[model samples]
Target chain A: MKIIKNLALGVSFIMSTQLVSAASTGTTLETVSPEADRIALQNFYKKRFPNTELQDYVNGIYAVDADSRTQWEDIEAFPPYEFDVEEGERLFNIAFANGKGYADCFENGGIGIRQNFPYWNKEEGTVKTLEQEINECRESNGEKALKWGKGPIAQISAYMAWTSRGKVFDISIPDGDKKALAAYLDGKKFFYSKRGQLNLSCANCHVQGSNIRIRADLASPALGHTSHFPVFRSKWGELGTLHRRYKGCHQDSRSNPLDMQSETFRNLEFFQTYMSNGLVVNGPGSRK
Target chain B: MRKLTTSMCVTGLVALLATSPASALTVEESIAEGKAVYMGKSRGNCISCHQINDPDANLPGNQGPPMFAMAQRFPDKRILRAQVWDATKNNPISIMPPLGKHWILSEEDIDAVVEYIYQF
Candidate 1:
């Protein structure tokens, strides 16, 4: 067993070396296969919480914390987000002044399609997130773009996620495209690299600090970090998109937060959502 | 002679640079500066990791061990400062950043933080 573990380590070291070289050369950096990363991440969570079922990870921190789960279940029974979900639905269907709607701008009229977002737009050579696309939809319709963080974006995204509930996140890295892979790599770097004056990475709290309590709340694991969107935060007292939460966390880390749906954030969403590929969408979630 | 030395020390541009960091900050003022660096929205904000014994703090985080009985933990304050300078020196995989190694905190800022940290 020890030998096998050593072998794995040796292999990872070799892959990392090659990846570094590949990165300098602008070639495909196959630093450990994405499949390997996915397995390792999933197994880490599974080993930590042996009692948790694989699929239940989609529930975020509630999947592991029994104390919080009880309260969350009770809250879930008559979710505080119900009104916001209803509001989102209302906003989503509203036609713009150009006599067009969000439906006119997406595949399958944008219903039940939240999971496929943060896609590598090969032609555009950039990662595109749901919020960015939604803004694009508004722009294409000759309407003004809504702010990507709190108010309208969250409401509309919550409504879309609700409609797409139970659909597994199907984010893709795409094949044979080096630039797309580089974007994913950049996103992965963003996730692991330490930043800000406090010098903490997303992994520090979400991964290393797993099940650790912060004041009154438990820090959620990163495995299904992106499963929930447009969370109804008690702190904010309003609906908030995933980027809003990211911005909040960056501020908490004393890092200067980028604009919502900014390149790095979109990349972060891409990489994190890829980690959450198998988890089902359970957005429009409420959190205290 | 001592009084003359003290006044002369305060007199000129040559001496000004020696005490350039806004004179000798009182203990209370140093602690305040340290806390500001530790609590600012876009700065060190150590409250995000370790809990500290500030009466006015929001009880922010509990990721690292709480900051209490620090003087007891490391009787020599330099050891404490070194630890903050690079926690990875002790533990290779430590999550705490090397504040000094990475230039995250200036020498004066670090001194202030160490003063505040050692007090509690």
Candidate 2:
């Protein structure tokens, strides 16, 4: 029984010692129930910002940051992303030598299909993002894949997202599909799991830091944070895609950001977009 | 003779186990480890939130307070340790992560992080 005694001692030591939350393990995490998670997320933001409307979240931080709203409104009135949207439309309509275009590769002639993206592609057994689909469309039509970080990728996505304006995000995990559900949960854990030398998660800023000032900037709530993508940042003086922002945030937190369009990112977008369900799409946004 | 051999083997194992923790590292080694974690992208990533006086830290964050005169602010190591364990305990709304409580860093890593920060 010497082995048993040692095992007992180890168990006792663990019980006596400070035990950590088990949800953050990178591997072997059970798929969290998505409906419960979504309801809980909605409840959390509701409690955090009791004064804000459910629909107003499309405006992002402006829904909560009144002082910045006026400037945001002014920016929106003459949005910096307008030219990019126009350019994106022009690119979207362009065809290849095969006499086919982006429209031939998607449903409804590829119009108003933004909210349907970042979906679980069961055949691929991975989440598919709009950027990936865009490139896939290009390749299928015998055209070169557009670079992912910015420029053409951002431009085309901007046009697609613009067309989807006022279409509430409808991301879903197909019924009874456990792998899809597992990916969704993994995405949720990624959002909550702390990383970087600063040991922070996306929730650390967006979820917990909402209405809290960090060097004069008000953090947005995580509930509808992903509604806007292919946003225009005045700081960069150009448009950037969602993955670009993901990389920027990870680096800012001192974590090694997964490569753009990596599995983790595709899953991350799936989770974030699913959380943003029912929030109106208002992309090609202008941000400070 | 068999019993004696078993006892001797057990004694040797016990001795090795007893000395392992004590001989784990010198302060200099711990400091080096702390520096690596503080600067490395995959580890503590301290530069993401706190700006330190170290020359190696580039593009330091302004989100949190500068990591300056830390040992003076909380002379007791426990005070600093408590903050690292869970800053939320002190302020419920604190944006800082509980490096220890969340399993982000193990106990020894937290100790190293504290030691490294104290140097700032």
Per-prediction DockQ: 0.14, 0.13
TM-score of each: 0.76, 0.70
lDDT (0-100) at residue A267 of candidate 1? 82
lDDT of 2 by residue, B79-108 (tens): 566677777565443456667887777788
lDDT of 1 by residue, A128-181 (tens): 888888899999888899988888888888988998899988887777777887
For model 1, report DockQ: 0.14
What 10-residue stretch in candidate 2 chain A is worst by lDDT? A7-16
Give every collision pair in model 2.
Answer: A196-B44, A197-B44, A197-B45, A197-B46, A198-B45
Clashes of 1: 1
Which candidate leads the pack in lDDT? 2
Per-residue alpha-carbon lDDT of candidate 2 for residues A60-109, written as tens digits (9 for 90 to 100)? 88888889999999989888999999999999998789999999998998
Give each model's whole-structure lDDT.
Answer: 0.75, 0.76
Clashes of each: 1, 5
Interface RMSD of each: 17.4, 13.6
Runs in model 2 lying further than 4 Å from the true structure: A1-31, B1-94, B97-120
